[model samples]
Target: MLGGKTPSEFMKLPIEERENILRGYLVTDDDVQIEEGDDFGLFNKEIATGSLLQQEYFMGEDEAGKQLVKEARQIYYRENTFSVRSHWLCEFICDTLADGKPIPIESLVQRIIVRVDVEDIYDMDDDMVDFMPEGEKEKSWVVRDLRQLLEFTNAEFIRIEVSGRGALDGSDPQTQEKIKEISGIVKTLIEQFGEKLTIRKLTQLNDGQSIFHDLRSWLMLE
Candidate 1:
C-alpha cells in the first residue's frame, strides 16, 4: 500500500505514521521481488534503494543527519546487534562526557542503563568463567572490577555515606582504605577524562552503616 503512494502523498501523512510504515517495510521479506531481467538476491535491491533515498531525504545529508538515519536503520532493520549497540553507546558516552558539558541524568539512564554489560566495558576472554563442572563448558563471566563499573556506567559523581556518632569518630581502617582506593581510581579517571568526574564522602550521625549513591537521583530535580 505504501509503495503505491507517491512521495508527496506519503510525505503528507503524519510523521509518526510514516515512520511506522517505513519500519515495517524495512524489515519485511515480502517487499523483495525480481523482474524478468533481474538477478537473484536475498532482498529487493530497488526497495532497499528507495528506502535509503527516503531516509536520506527525511534525515538530510549532514553528519548528524547521517547518524540519525544510521540509528533509525539499525532499529528498523534489526541490524543493532548487542555488540554493535554496546559499542555505539560506549562511543557516545566517551564523546559526550569528554565535551565538558553537563549531561542529563535522564538521558544517560534511559539510553545506557540496562543495555550495557560487563563484557562491553572490559577486554575479557569469551570463555572466562568463575566455575564449571569437570567436563562442562565455561559460562559467561561476571563484572568484578569497580573501575569498569564506574567507567562503563558513566557514573561520574558517587556519594559514599559513612556513619559515625561524632565528628571525632571515623570509618574503620578497612573501610577507609577501600574508600581511598576508590577515590584514587576516581582521581585517575578525572585525570584521563577531565574534571567532570568527582566523588563525595558524607559522614552521617550514626554507626554500623555505609551506603553508596549516584547522581542519578538529581534527575528528579531536572
Candidate 2:
C-alpha cells in the first residue's frame, strides 16, 4: 500500500504527477484489471479480494471477440458440427463467414450442427423492453445477430439443434412445452430461409449432453 501519506499529499502534487501516482496505485490495487479503469477500486486489499470471489473475470471486448474465431475453428477446421451455448455464438459464426473471414482448414465443412439452448431460442422483439429506461431502446442483438445470421454462411447444410430443459420424448410436461416452442422457432427459420437450416437432433444442456455434444466432437471416426 502507498500508505496514508499519498492521500494526504495528493493535492500538493502537479496534475501530471498526481495522474502518475494514481496510475501507480491502480497498478498495485487492480487485481482484476482487464485494461483501463472499468470500475477500478480504491478499497482495502482484503475487502477487494473477498469481493472478487463473487465476481466474474473480466475480458476486454477485443479479447472476448477472439473467442468467436477460436470457436469457428473448433467447428469448421475439421468436423462441421458446432454446438452453441449462447445464441450469440451462432450469430458470431454467421458474421465471420459473411464478412469473408474464412476459417482455416484442409477439408470442406459441408454440414454444420449449430446447437442453441432451448431457453435461449426466440425471434427477437423490436419494442423496448419494459425493464429498460425510457428513451434508451437498444435493439436486441438477436435481431441483428442470430436472426440475420442464417441468411448467409459457408456451409451447405446447417442444422440448428435446440438443447437443454428437457428432451422431446421426456415425461416432463414443462420440458416438452419448451421443446415444442423451440420446434416452432426453428420451423420459422427454415420456412423463411429455406432448407439450409434444419434441426436433426435435440440434446440436453446438462452434464451428459455436454460430454456427448461438446466433449469429443460427437465421439465419431469422421
Candidate 3:
C-alpha cells in the first residue's frame, strides 16, 4: 500500500490508475552526491531535473501555476527565470483595467503581447504541445494572441502602448488620475524587478503635455 491500499491491491488496478499513483509519489533527487571526476552523474542529474520540470509545467492547471513551473524550468535550462515575475505584472495590469469594466479575452491577450516577450514560433522538433497549424505541417503558434505564451517564453520586458483615441489629455482630470495610477503600478514593478524587467510606454498622442506623454516620461525617469 502506498497511500491507503496495499501494494498487492494497487497492483491489481488498471494501468492508468497505477501510472497516476506512481506519478503522484514520484520523487527525484534534489541534492545528488557526486564523487570526484564523476561529471557524467552531474550531467544526468541536470537532464533528469529538466524532464521533471517539463512534466510539472504540462500538468499545471492554470496560467499562474504553469508560469511558476516554467520559471523553474527556465532556471534549470540556465535561461532567464523572470517569466513568472512578468506574468504577475500582466495580472496586475489586468486587475487595474478590470476595476473599470470587465476585460475581454481578446483585449487581455493583446495586453499580454504588449507586455511580455513571447516565443511566437517553434520548430516541430520542439518538445512543446498544443501548437497551431502553419502552412504544411503544424508548428508552434505565434505568441502574439495566446496567453499561454507566458508559460513558454522568457517574458521579462513589458511594453505598453496608450492610444490617443480616447481623452488622454490633462483636461480630463479623472482620466489623468487613472493614468497616474497606472503609471505608479509600472514604476513599482520596475523598482521590484530592477534589471530583471524593462518596462516601456508607447503613445500615439502628439501632445507633449498629455497624460500619455507624462506616463512615458515617468517610466523613463525610473
Winner by TM-score = 2
TM-score, candidate number 1: 0.25
lDDT, model 1, position 53: 31
For each candidate in the order shown, give its overall lDDT on alpha carbons.
Answer: 0.37, 0.39, 0.35
Q: For model 2, how big is the CA root-mean-square deviation? A: 16.1
Q: Supply the TM-score for candidate 2.
A: 0.36
Instruction: Output the better candidate (2/3) by TM-score.
Output: 2
For model 2, the stretches where C-alpha displacement exceeds 4 angstroms are: 1-81, 94-110, 119-146, 165-171, 179-185, 192-196, 204-222
My TM-score estimates for the predictions, one after another, are 0.25, 0.36, 0.24
| Clash count list over all predictions | 0, 0, 2
RMSD of each: 17.0, 16.1, 18.2
- Evaluation by lDDT, superior candidate among 1 and 3: 1
Instruction: Provide the lDDT at 81 for model 3.
Output: 21
Task: Write down the lDDT that model 3 would get.
Answer: 0.35
Query: Residue-wise lDDT of candidate 3 within 87-179, one digit each (tens)?
Result: 233332331111233222211222122322211122245444434345323232222222333332333433443333334332244334334
